[model samples]
Structures are given as structure tokens and as C-alpha cells.
Target: MSDEKVKIDVPEVPSVLPPAEQKKWVETYKAAFEEAQNDDPGDVVKQRQSALREANRLLRVEKITSADQAKALPKWKLVQCEEKDGVLKVVTIDGKKYSFGVGRGAKQQAPAGQGGGQNGAGQQGGGASTPPPAA
Candidate 1:
């Protein structure tokens, strides 16, 4: 017998959430978003947008896993976050809405060895700035 593995290719659907579930999740996100807006009531349009993105991402991962369709790269994104003027903003490919992780805590630290001495963003790992930090 040959020891060969069969490969299965699953189509990447825009959304893993079922139609009904998608609506429900969207509604939930909207509610959370409204609550945040009310609490802050400041000029944090971008931050709110980012929060919405992260929330939705988490929700999608939960839904997909529940549906037993979570593959290698569950498409989970911590949700790109940006902080400006004490307010945090988040965004994704398309205009999605979510409301979570707004002004939670300290900024995120890159997992060591991820961004070596490339892109002029400093060396990888130890967050070292290249060019030898102007001796």
C-alpha cells in the first residue's frame, strides 16, 4: 500500500458565518459599538472603527470554530489597532464594524525575532533600533 495523503481544498467564503448567524453577529456588534460611543462620547471615530473590527474578528473565529470549519490559519486577526491622541483606532480590508478592545491596556509588543533589521523599523526581537543607535 502507498502512504499517500489526500488533500482537500475548501473554498474560502467571504464569511464563514451562516446567513442568519451573520445578521445576528452584526446586530450584536452594532449594540456594543453604540454603547462604546455613548460611554466615550468623544472624537474617536477611528478608534471606534478599530474596536468594531477586532470584535468582529473574534466573533467570526468563534462562529467558524463552532461550525467545525476552522482550518490551519483560522483567519483570525487581532484587528489592526492604531492609537492617536489617547484614542485608539482600528481598521481592516473592507469597512467592517465591531466594538471591542478600546483603550484596554499597554501597547502590544512584537513576538521576538519577527522584525529583524529590516524595513528600517529597527532590528527584530529585542526592539533594537538599527544603525547601532548612533554610537
Candidate 2:
């Protein structure tokens, strides 16, 4: 018998974003997708506003996080937060960056559940994924 057991080094899977965030991401991305399809910035902006309003509204509706906290402006939660031209450069939990006009990331989701993609599969692709990047 082999004295040493086989050491299975399982590859870590990525984490998925939260449902609330996923909902917001889907809404915004879908709107932008439609806008991109139409090639209308006006429509894009309009839909973008709509999405933002809805996102904020959802956050407000849920009351999970404060709608008015100095550091909690309730913008999209990103992998990284950047600032430019008084706008926020938020990288979606999936690493996609977008320009949010102004506000802190109102993401109340635990870091683990902040960026799950389609079908709630999350970044891990399933339950067998690795941890997400460090905050």
C-alpha cells in the first residue's frame, strides 16, 4: 500500500455576484446592449438613467443598505473603484468597467456574492470555484 495519499489539488473556481447585483447588472447591461444595438447615445443615456434609477430604487426598495451614507452612495459594486472627470469608473463584479456619474458603490452583497453572472452560476461556474480577488 502507498503510504502517501494522493494530494488532489483542486483548481479554485471564481465567485459569482449577488442576486441583487446580478439583477442590477443584467438591467444595466441589457439596456446598454439594446442601446449598442440601436447605436443611439440618447437612447443609451435615457436607458442608462432608467437603469440607474431602477438600481437605486431597488436598493431603496430593499432597504438593505442606506440610500444616504457618506461613503455609501449606492453605485454599482465593481472589482475596482476608479475616479475620473467627476465620474466613477466602476468595474463590474465581472471586471467590466462603466462610468457611473456619482455615488459610492451601494453594494450590500457580501464580497462572495457580488458578481454572479447568468443563471446564478456565479464566477465559479458552480460550487467548485475558487475565491475571488482580494478587496
**Which candidate leads the pack in lDDT?**
2
Which parts of model 2 are misplaced by more than 4 Å? 1-11, 15-77, 103-135
| lDDT by residue (tens digit), candidate 2, 23-122 | 5655655554454434433344454454444444433312222222312534434355554444444444434333333444433222223444322212
Clashing pairs in 1: 47-88, 47-89, 50-90, 52-98, 52-99, 113-125, 115-124, 116-124
Which stretches of model 1 miss by more than 4 angstroms?
1-14, 44-47, 57-135
Highest-scoring model, TM-score: 1
TM-scores vs. true structure, each candidate = 0.30, 0.22
Model 1 agreement with the true structure over 82-106: per-residue lDDT tens digits: 4444333332333232212224442
- TM value for model 2: 0.22
Q: How accurate is candidate 2 locally (lDDT)?
A: 0.40
lDDT of 2 at 3: 34
Note each model's CA RMSD in angstroms. 20.6, 23.2
